[model samples]
Target: MTGEYLAGRGAYILGLITKRIWFRASLFSVAAILTALVAGWVAPFIPYELSLTVGGKAVDNILTILASSMLAVTTFALSASVGAYGSATSTVTPRATQLLVDDRFTQNALSTFVGTFLFSIVGIIALTTGLYGPEGRVVLFFATIVIVAVIAITLLRWIQHLSSFGRVRDTIERVETVARRAMQAWAEAPHLGAQPPVAIPTGLLSVYPADTGYVAHIDVAGLARIAERYGLTVHIAELPGAFVYPERPLAHVSEAVDDKARMAIKNTFSILPDRRFDQDPRFGLIVLSEIASRALSPAVNDPGTAIRVLGAGHRTLADFVDTKRGAKACIHLRVHAPALTIDDMFNDFFRPIARDGASVVEVQLRLCATLSSLAAHAPDIFGKIARRHADAAKMRADDALSFEGDRAALHMSDF
Candidate 1:
């Protein structure tokens, strides 16, 4: 089952690549031919190596041109194939997460497919043609292989980004789950009132005018800082922007949120704490502000030993600001225009939170739901951008198809 999932999904990802301009093998071929032609033109005449008359007709020049053309085509193909591998890996991961039943196994399969696919093709080419030889063709062939390897390495980082996403998704789920369970346990134990701590989800609250929306530029820094001070690890990594080689293409985010609390604090202060750490679900607290300062008290403790924190992200940020006097922080940039409104705000943050999760299955299901909503609302967004940027519009089509198909599968499973 695992192998089948890997092969099937990997192929699907590869199929996605075929539709993209970058994966069109012909371009690489053309480049190789051009490189050979240019090199041949500059070659000094050697009586032994270069002969205008070969038995009957002039052939050395013609052969050089022909070989160069072949080399160009081969080189282009090899270069483009690197992009193909990247696109394939990226596509397979998110789809498998949503479509496959067993996520861990799916992830393993996806990883294997990445390593195996690259190795098999390159390995076969190397084995069949002697990589080290006196023949120029053989030498050129090996060089082409090397170029392909470089491209593959450069592009495969997208797979790593996707893997990071999976890990982050898992961590966020735990944060939510542990918090929810802790709240429930606190409310149920002993003398709790009818109304427990009202826990709003992550994407909820009045996101400052600029903070709202599906656009990448959300005002998360304030919340991130608050999360840090409170002990939730915050590592702010950039989300993949428009299908480039992933690896968190963010340049310089003053602060990023991580799902781990201790790490968050450590990162915020830029200090390494003198303590060993493992992910423990026992650090929940409730804060009450007084005239002098804010007071934190243990609000809920689970019998099974789960600790959860209470308070919205924004409120936490406010607390951090109040306590710290003056500190650099994230603020919303408002755009008061006639076209946008509050519903946009609701969709921007709250909607995602309404679709909550605590496990991989739950996160996958929720992600599918959230993404579907975004796609339906913004179909032309990714479609238009991809079409304009990638020389081949097929890339746009494949991306749309993958996201759309994944959305549908998730919807079907809703039954």
Candidate 2:
């Protein structure tokens, strides 16, 4: 039980760290400082013959130049990043801004630039203070060269990244990638290592959340352990990514638990102001749909982008259904969780597109084709869900499309 709690806590902390750009930048900055310090300390132990005949003034000049240039570079990069974020929020879905902010390539490039700047500043201070001997200057000079190389590489990569940073296509791809990963994880463990949820027994006590927010993550392992300790069967009422209010029950325990146990169970759920895609596959799907809907809006009227997003959504659902084949259920948990249905996933991704793109014959035809493909490949339950959406989309197309030929062309053979 303790292990489960710690594991859950660790994962949450890691998620928090990854989400913040500064955490990684701070780590790299510290590493840069330590590298300089260690190299200076070790310099004297090396033989004088191996030391380069670099002058103090020369090393000082290089360090000064690096320090000043890096400062400007850091500022420019920060401004560019801010611009990218703002553009993304305004042009793309605002929810996608978080992903852009947390992007690994962009963050790493910025961190490298900032870390190099700090390294040079420290080296300059140490040099001016006469903290390093002749041998130390050699180490500092070599380190300076390496840092310059790193800075150049990072600058080049940052330039390339800027080209598409926060663009709609890039944001959609990022969201799709994240959503696909989440779907893979869920498909692998759809019940979250618990039996399929059943009706709460008549005597079981319902536990409500003290605060209201989206249920970001559920510590299923912790919940299972808590259920085991209390000799109770627990049924979760809310899934990760679900929004909860004070009145809604979070879970039901087979027997009444005391205040302490109730608190522990509540702790198993992590509530936050917004949903994340790492744990919530549905959130990713919704984000993709948002991007498509934005493109299909009258102001944008970009049916091509909407069509591309439909393909992405179709591919994601296809992968999800394919992964579920021959999958085994988790048998070891004491807590039960509700399973997400194909109908829900279909609605989450395609409903908005169907509504927003009703007037665009191209988008409507593409949506119906995607749905037909999914229906053909999906199992019986999922095929029905896909056909239902196809029919609904066709009805919407018939009502909104100006010409009967366009509406007739939107029909799916399977539907």
Candidate 3:
């Protein structure tokens, strides 16, 4: 049965839209323009004496200065942001750049800068056209004061944000935060609130992917609705973050699937060129592991970074295990999707670091320790997988570590 997903298609789409920089910027611009126009409406409510106290010339000068300065500030901000993106790509991993791009603090700062610029421009235009009489000018002046204050505070915060904006720790924190969120969401709605799919029944109809790419999102609720309406069982063959080809099955329908049904089913699975972090827990783990791998690379040779990321990965997994997800809340009884395997997560989160940092004793020690700790997290589930990785890491250390002391040190560690 294709049951409802915790997040519907609209929510999934909205999640993507909100991550965009321009969306927030466009909203801020529109709001600024509205604010400029609203002064005329507010003008009537202000007393004539208040208008007399407000100087049109001073308001005009402030707007002029604000407009000119904001243009320069916005340009600098863009350049800084672009530089940070480049830095994150080179020092961290290209995969992490998207997170930085979607950073709310940076986005809001840029939006404020752009919005304030537009607000100033509109206010100046209104002033020049005499759209704001003395009363209107008073309202506009007060608005300008508020804008200036906001800009001042924003500038200070932005300056502080830029200090570690694209640094390695910052990027890793960003990845860790997202990875935790994904894990938490998964914990809340295990298997997307669907039954763990069993072996396909003999006569199940297969739905193939139309394109070759990663499954970015799956509209689970849509499938449930379609399945319920059509009176069929829909077993989701792939989860978000899965790579798919034309030959691969996206889902299996229990009844005969018509052209309309096939298309509808396919639409529920959004395939994109790259995997996204949202709705994809494993992708976050993979990206975090990738960061550790990059840090372990000979070009960078930054083991400290890899070590820090291990801590993040450990914390992310530990949080998932520790979360009080009492029972499997299966909401979408109609949709059957596979549950995430701990082994795969262990591989995704730690295998690469173990492989790449095999030579470093500190890396191996940290890796083995984290694995043993994870094994202790849920002995039945994580114990075996954690031991598997720990054994692999120990084996790698045996080959890579020249001194017996180093080998013995790793062998002696227990959780």
Candidate 4:
């Protein structure tokens, strides 16, 4: 290990932080505190007569009520969000739950509640401590009323959001949105801004990882810099979502490198205990398949959801194929990365669901149609894999499904 901190890219780090629930809530709370102090700053411009009519008593009472009530409301909102996560895990799939945890709608609702509570607390503290004079009190009163209105609006929006917060359809849509974006990015830059891989040289030195796990992210720019400094050609052996152990070679260097260079190369790859959605587009496909598999389980027996996932998968893959034809060459000069294959993507998205939903005639029909549709869109790219999965799924369906009529209907499609 380089013993250097691996922070990934700045933009990637910022993306991760923004997805966090506490980060949003903390920002809101800080804003609320700052808003509380503004009353004193703007008080000088207000008329003294206006301050006489609106005493501190009304504002204090409102703040006290908000402070007391908002805590309970915030607690309840948190519980609901937690419950949604659990429901999504059980009903959808564990892999799909992280999206819920990082969902902006859920985070925003909780942040509003938490921020409002903190604002109330600050207002009450200021009033009791005589921090604001009469004009400040008048300003504070108007601020309290505005905040109350905001709270009311937030509550209304929260109620509407809760209706389908963690529902299977809602969660699946979220997954589709993320997967499509990742796929589009992958299509646009299949090599992650690195040059396409060339054949390995006769006798290159291999660089091994110190830790073992999935490659969550690769700092290609960092790799390029290292390659430039060492005057070496770097062939990446593993990409993001690929598992590695201490024994596995992460890259092959053209020549022997110093310890610092070796460590710098190693530190460029961020290996995590689990895969993340940002870089590895195929991980998202696997997750959608997992969700379908869970729905097809005997305990759940929701073939409709499985069929729906097939459509989501189809749409995501279709978008990739459409964008891939015009993809531009990557710009990085020193780093070489293997391109992600559509064959692997087809397997990641369709295999498990084909196994789990084998017996469901509707699911099989939908699966065949989904594959056939993709093949129709880009036969050169997906036709072979689509037919391959369709054949495999057909055999499974034929065995699991006893009725000949259902099998006849499945055979009706030319998938």
Candidate 5:
């Protein structure tokens, strides 16, 4: 209710200003026209019988000439007002200015037209009703000029208030920077399965330096739930913690430690394959985390369990490499053991590429599946997945596989 009242007040104020300007311009035009009509048509016919007394002296001829000159002056003033309005409108209308004050050219033109028409009607009545005396014409002409001046001053003040050159320049610069970053992110992001680009805001979070490196904290559970609920087949790196960017890649973290932790996490009994696991359906990650290391201990580990654990770890590592940006990458570990698991997983995941020729088709398929899964359930996460896939595809083509200029190239588009 308060908001509505304020809005109403604002609108009323605007209307009042508009009406004032319009009436002023109209009256000025009318005054000018009246002067012209009186000098050109009425004054010449002023009968000698209607001689006016000026300064207590009979000065009929002098009075007539003076009145005619005033009329001419008023006419020129009115014409000038109209011309000013036209010029102002032209200057302000082309660019859609951020400041409303600069838009007054159009407003002034509208007001002038209405004001002029009203003035004409009033002047015509005043003249026809025998109210056409030298005194009356002079008074009306001066009043009209005053009105036009007042309105012009008000409009000029408004323009000055609306446009701050410094502010506008700053806003433009910021907008340009944001746009550039967005474009670059899109270009660099992965897009497996030829999926659309992810719409992540660049400045959504601030980067903070941690003990190891810079960390970017973000919640991924929301995305995970969305993906699961929607039955998406996309690959999502659901790290509730912040992503760490270290100075060196795989330099601070030990590959052996990571491998050991990952193996342990995998040995832990997986909730995914358990009957009681799906009861809550939310313990998927928890279950995996618990069984990873416990069930895969070197003393009593099953080969099958180990393979699944290794595979899952590899998938997570792939996702990290594909999506991560900048020079350094960091892993956050609220659960200390998982940090080692991640390192080991990453090492093992990439180690195979050195000896064997990496299968482009396999990688592409994995990327497609990951992106598709993400889109189906968690479109937001899916967008991220799709972005990483696209980036991976590009990397594979550029550095890993030499399929340049090959129309029959293996790309997400081909799938």
Candidate 6:
């Protein structure tokens, strides 16, 4: 399989798993129970016998308290998490909620809490059933102490995480981070290591998707293998982030193929309900723009957030361009995929901000400055696009700002 194909598949699976709370929690809970069971089984084999001052009743009382308190904590945590998710969805863009849902610290903290609670419950039941002898009780007591320590640390961190979990600023940072990774991946393998076809071959047979959805991933390796096996040249019409329907062609084969080969080609394309950032950097850019647009809305009127997002977008794009210099070459494939264009990137990320933040002087000025900086560092085409955006933003500023001085300050000459 091609590296891009494997990376896409891995990202798809990891994305699905990390977004769900139960998967990590269940794994932790099982580990907790298993650890307790294993400790109990080995307790009697200890070589040293010691006089333990702690009594069974005392241990029982401690376990009882832990179990009850943990139940309360878990319930509270669940409620708080729900509220955070709801608040994030209502206040910020709903697209950002996915990042909050998949937060590692929050997931780890909750899973740790739930697992420790299960550990205590299992330990208590084992102690009460006479399954553990005196030595086993001693082991369980020590284990309980360790569990308490763990719970204390987790609780402290969870408190810290909750402080900014669903806040707009935190959500934006999370989105930026995901966007950066996606951009870097795209920069490294612009065409999934396949050379772009010179042009669409004449008389190519078109292959369409069976259903309508966003193109989540493309199995380039599999496509290449199929092309090589069938002695055909395949041209991918849709990139990973493109939405495809029954009427749209997914790919174009140089020659007509049997139903089985057509089905094989179709299977290489993964269609999902929503676009993901890992394979589709454009989705990330779109999300960042959405946040900026939301911030610029009359209801929110948060220009600072919009400005910060602009800076973030600038940095991400700059890095994407800078990294291209050192990007590793990919193995050639029989299939060819189209490269993402700078114009599309700008449209996805900056156009909305420019349109929505037209009235805000600070936002307009920042956009011009950012675009100018990008233009300075980018190729001729990038510079041209940047100038286009800067000029458009200035027009909006002139119309929106009442003061001539304000409009003059935002003049294109400054950029």
For candidate 6, report its TM-score: 0.93
Residue lDDT tens for model 4, 1-415? 1111123465556767788898999999999998888899999999999988786477888888999999999999999999999999888888889989988878988998999999999988888888898899899899889989988998999999999999999999999988887777777666777889899988899999999899888888788888888898899999889999999999999989999899999988878898887667898899999989989999999998998899899888987767752233465688899988887898898989889989999999999999899899989988898999999999999999999999999998768
Each prediction's TM-score versus the true structure:
0.22, 0.94, 0.96, 0.94, 0.21, 0.93
Worst 10 residues of 3 by lDDT: 1-10
Best by lDDT: 3
Compared with the true structure, all predictions reach lDDT values of: 0.29, 0.81, 0.87, 0.86, 0.34, 0.81
lDDT of 2 by residue, 1-415 (tens): 1121123745876777766998999999999998777767988786686564465565778778888888888899989989989987877799999988988888888888888888888887787788888788888788888888888888898899999988888888888888887777777666665678777678778889988899888888788889889898889998888999889989999888899999999988888889977667788889889989989888988998999899888878876766652233464367888987777888899999999999998888888888888877865756777778888988888889988788777763445
Clashing pairs counted in every model: 23, 0, 6, 0, 32, 0
Indicate whether candidate 1 or candidate 3 has the larger lDDT.
3
The best candidate in terms of TM-score:
3
Query: How well does model 2 score by local distance difference test?
Result: 0.81
Residue 280 CA displacement from its true place in model 6, Å: 1.1
Question: What would the C-alpha RMSD of candidate 3 be, to one decimal place?
Answer: 2.4
lDDT digits (tens) for residues 1-415 of candidate 1: 1111112223434543454443433444454444333333333322323332222122233333433443444344344434433443343222212212222332332333333333334433433454312233333333445544544563465345345443323432333343234333322221111111223325321211112121111123333445436533222222111111223222122233444533322222211111101111012111101100111112321111111111221222222112321111112121110111223322322222222211123323433343343334444532232222222212322333446654444446422
Residue 372, candidate 6: C-alpha displacement in angstroms: 1.0
What tens-digit string does per-residue lDDT give for candidate 5 at 1-415?
1111112223433544554645555655665555534532444454433334222122233334434443454454445545443432333221112222223443454344444444545555555566656544444444445545654574465355335322323222322232233222322322211122233333222222213422111122222233244333222122212233323221111122344333332222111112211111112222222223323344534333323433443333334334443321111111111122322322233222211222343434343444444445444434554555445544554565555543135453432
Question: For every candidate structure, what is the RMSD over all alpha carbons to the true structure, in angstroms?
Answer: 23.0, 2.7, 2.4, 3.5, 26.5, 2.4
Between prediction 1 and prediction 6, which has the larger TM-score? 6
Which stretches of candidate 1 lie above 4 Å from their native place?
A: 1-26, 36-337, 351-415
